[model samples]
Target: MESTMTGNASGKKKEIHVGLCGAGIGGVFAAIAIARAGAKVTVLEAADHLGEIGAGIQMTPNVARLLRKYGVDKVIGDNLVRFEELNLRRKDGTPVGYTQTSRIEGALDQPWWLVHRHHLHQGLVTVARQHGCNLMIGSRVVEIDYLESNEVTVRTEAGETHVFDLLIGSDGINSVVRRTLFPAVKPRPPTTNCAYRAIVPYEQIRHDPIASTLIQKLTMEVWMSEKAYIISYPISAGTDFNMVLSHHRPHPVSTVEDISMADLRAEYATFDPRIQRIVDMIPNAQRWPLLVTGPLPSWSSPRGNVVLMGDAAHSMTNHMAQGAATSMEDGAFLSVVLREVLAARIALPDAIRLYERERMPKAFRKQQVSFLNGAIWQLPEGEAQRARDRAMEPELRGEPLLRSPNLYGDPATVLEVYGYDAEAHAERALQEWYNGQDWRKDEGTGIEAPVAEKVMNWFLPEKEKFVSKI
Candidate 1:
């Protein structure tokens, strides 16, 4: 109901408040970035506590650079395993594709890092608090009353309601904000591919002869077959090994964290014996389906006061290892474009539009690429599999490639995808889009649309329909 100007070091700009749902890495980092850009951001998290979480994640150079920029690299320094090598192989260690992590650093100027999900999340939360971002732990956003008049009220499970100029839904694949706002639409159809994830102590493998050789401190090895694969890397300062066994199933599964090792072994029966041995060392595993979100026609609400972020925007599979990276990019890009709102160069809606136009295409591209790579990985042992193997020939032989089936082995992709600078990319796109734009803003307070457009929007009975459609 109230809008005013706030004077800061940058200049006198519109005082804006954002209600952010979900405090995962993406949400928290977005808070930090937005607060640094001089906005007031409140993060509503469902979890009561974000403690020493488990599992490991591969951080590509692109995201690794961002983490470093925020000093997160220093915070999670001791917990990282700088990847020295990446191997794509059959269960028996036959090479499907391989690359030295040095190549990533040599071309992208940043190291490939493997870290515990908790460490990364912790690092983001630390920086976010430092940036004056407010955190509401245990406050699950159950109702997002986003209206056509640019009014958004977020109600949590605890019955407290808060209003903000904007709402960002980084609430993850099963986002409450998304469900509350766009109740009819679904993220994706159920997925068939699921995975069993477990962490075994490094000492367990160290005592076993075969399993010990299968793992190394600075290596990530992925073992695959026609239908199943296993990804293993060290995490938590190399004290444990993170193992993910991807398997295909005929029916959908309800995800459970503590699945019996018997079920895991039975499912992965056809996988490499080495993988089986590694599975034997695991006491428990979690069966998590590789869920994906259908790409929204637009990542913003029709009014633009409310929007989606991270997996809330574009959830995908694990093939590209870019889910976190791309989500973080979403935050960094938002920080840049939203600054235009704070500076009065663009209204909030236009800023979101610009952010969507510039960022969504790339995010969608990553989604498709991730799905494609998963398909390539699951090809049965036949001509298709051979074709995939041949696709790796150029990179394996130390030669140049023109769009290899193996996305990771492509040098051009390595450069373009890994070396991407989010702020630079958004700035360039916005500059071009802003220059050609026809609308004007009243010093960022509001957009000055023609009378007809305003009247039409005012008359529309179902504005949420437009937002959902868009």
Candidate 2:
């Protein structure tokens, strides 16, 4: 597939093709969306073999709703475990605040789900295949060419040249597309915050009394101490449990050269006795420094055809668990805007800008909020701990954190974010591009697409197979 770069100054969609970089979750879904909108999409993944590695991912209702609309709900539904609450507590496991996941669920008009990342990626890959999205794995993008006509030509490490109407830089934080677009800015190094993620089988935990209790609750629990926080949740719900320990480290670099179960136990030695019991049950762990980036000046290329998505565009700490959700939202919105722009015969450059215009502000806001959440979650040691204790002491005794002026100074601030409907916004954006509709009306009216089941059941059998094997 090849095409000579040309300016669509006349605003026509007859010649737009998209080259999507990265075949991870973001790139896969983006391909599905663009293909569903009747556009030709080519996905280039770097890894020789493409697969997901993470244990558990929290998919908010907003994200679920988008998956439902984009014809990938079957896989998501089959792979997800619905989580109903967000429980916050002190290091000793004393309750500080508990909020019903329903508040977020009802707002997004879908269920909040915890799913294994591999299954989610497989589901997206399946959908893309069904939609005629050409996927080439092991094709690492080494360079990008953004022409004056707002077209992109990507060259792979194998010396293969792929040209398309638009190039999407979904390759991730260390994106080659991003580097080529903005060479001056080096990616920020990993910060002091480090995390150890481990998944333990539920059967092993059933033998241990304390571990069994933590697993039986079906609750995503967090034990917070001045030094660190331990969070674990049932992923396959009774089959396996995933654990994440977040802590502040001194300037000395902590490497995971010999990351054994013993090392994991030692790290959590200071955790509450109950948390320690669960940590002891864990047989394996992977440690990595959590790297985050502040907001960027622009997410689009200087000429406008190439753009970034997900971690590539805005990599932030996982304090809010909105990383995957935001990326899914990006995939959903980009597909719609690109399709509408083509259908209405809008200029390619303007279409790209419109996308950047709509997504950048929302993404930047989430990035900022996520950063703040991380800072608050991992406050400085001495006086900060005391101040947190004073603020939480009343709440622990029975007052709600929402009302204590501690957690959230005003709960209303949440309405701005938890309440966003990305699909509704995409539709309004489509209407504006196709029929001259108002953009402001789409802003926060809570108008969302009602959930629908996809016709294809491609993922049902795979889910059954994975579950049965497990």
Candidate 3:
């Protein structure tokens, strides 16, 4: 294998030697982005087979644009469902929060899609290969050492050590690279929450006429309760419906090893009959314990040549369905920063610092939203949950006091999340940095930690009635 970019050097085109630690969605997209910027990319994966573990996953417009920007959007769009609307309802089936899917695409000029995790994974792998990335499966990076020269040497389980100018860890939340960098960062305990997921054939869905129609629609519908939240969407050309039922209770069997239909039914026994009926058809359901992590002390190694991405850097709750979307966004923004660094001839450490400085604040803001969503959805119904729901109803109905800038804001609401243009910011930041300016630290002018908190509280206010009711 060629070890350096000089082996196949052509005139004029700048070449970067990049090594990626995981071949998952984030890793593959990073490869695509770096390759588009004229880099020689190599990906290493621990899994012998290149299949994802989950059932279906959602990709919002933010992720959609990243894939489109990297030329992999068509692969995802060709095999996924484009949700036209997103409906949030109470357990009793009363509508709560509503938003047109058009707003997402309109804000970002890209569409949202839902696909099987395996399908999207395969699509990303295909795109990565087409873009000239060398994907080496079953070669897990067992250790990483940042040399004095600002290069990285990664040692794999197969007893191979590869040195590269830069190393990226996209190895999910259980990142080997992250653990090596910071052994003290323990995985957060199960948020007292777990989800049971399965995909049932669309034909079987028709058995329940009312739900079957809803299941076939081009919408992502979620029903919220203090006990749990139910999310269902159409995937596989409406031939199947993806379902995830989450709750805030411990299970008799926490491991995915022994999960069966009976175990699933017992966990979901208190849900609506409609949801229970759907779970009954699923002979086997996978159990996934939810986890949380705080902002890292540092997202990049002290060497600056090593950095984390995706779940390794920040793993948020799935309440907002932003985990995968945010990972893709990370890849997009990280790529732009790397390109800027290269153009400006910035040192590797400074570039990594710049990337983390620009990415962390936005990622943290989303993480806060995800945490609040989990709290609201998992609150047990009593006087507290009931009063909390009542407070949210007004906000859902367009109360002026509750209206502000958020991920779900309507027209006239500034697009902070979806409307962001990382490519543009990156280009400007690069030009400024090259001209000996410190634009990285000042990327988000007037956007501070307190400002983000205040903005978030506008949509989600503290419910004194909830505390008093309890």
Best by lDDT: 1
Evaluation by lDDT, superior candidate among 2 and 3: 3
**lDDT per residue, candidate 1, 1-470, as tens digits?**
12232235556678799878989888888898888888999998888985434488878888888888888888778897876777787666777777777876876668788888998888888888888899989998777777756869888889999998999998888888777667665655245787777888888877877767776456888776776778888888888788877877788654544667688877766666666777887886677877777677877777888989899888888878888889899999999888878887777887887788778888888888787777777788879778888878666666666677666757667766777778767766565555455433334445333322233432355553222111
Number of clashes found in candidate 2: 0
Query: In angstroms, how far off is 192's CA in candidate 3?
Result: 0.8
Off by over 4 Å in 3: 1-14, 251-257, 387-414, 431-470
Candidate 2 lDDT over residue span 1-470, tens digit each: 12122345556557468888988888888888888887889999999887888678776665776677766768555667776565666676666555566655654467767777887787788888989998998899887878665567788999899888788888876788777777775545346777787777778878887656665557777766665777777676446787778876675223443456676677678666766887877666677655554467877776678888888887766767777778777888887777765665555666666677788888878777766666666666678766765765654444445533232222444444555567666665655544444432313442221211112221346454222211
- Give the top-scoring candidate (TM-score): 1
Q: Estimate each model's TM-score.
A: 0.87, 0.83, 0.83
Query: Model 2: runs farther than 4 Å from truth?
Result: 1-15, 252-263, 380-414, 429-470
lDDT of each: 0.77, 0.69, 0.70
- The candidate with the higher lDDT, 1 or 2, is 1
lDDT of 3 by residue, 322-380 (tens): 77777777777667766644554555566677677677887888788777766766667
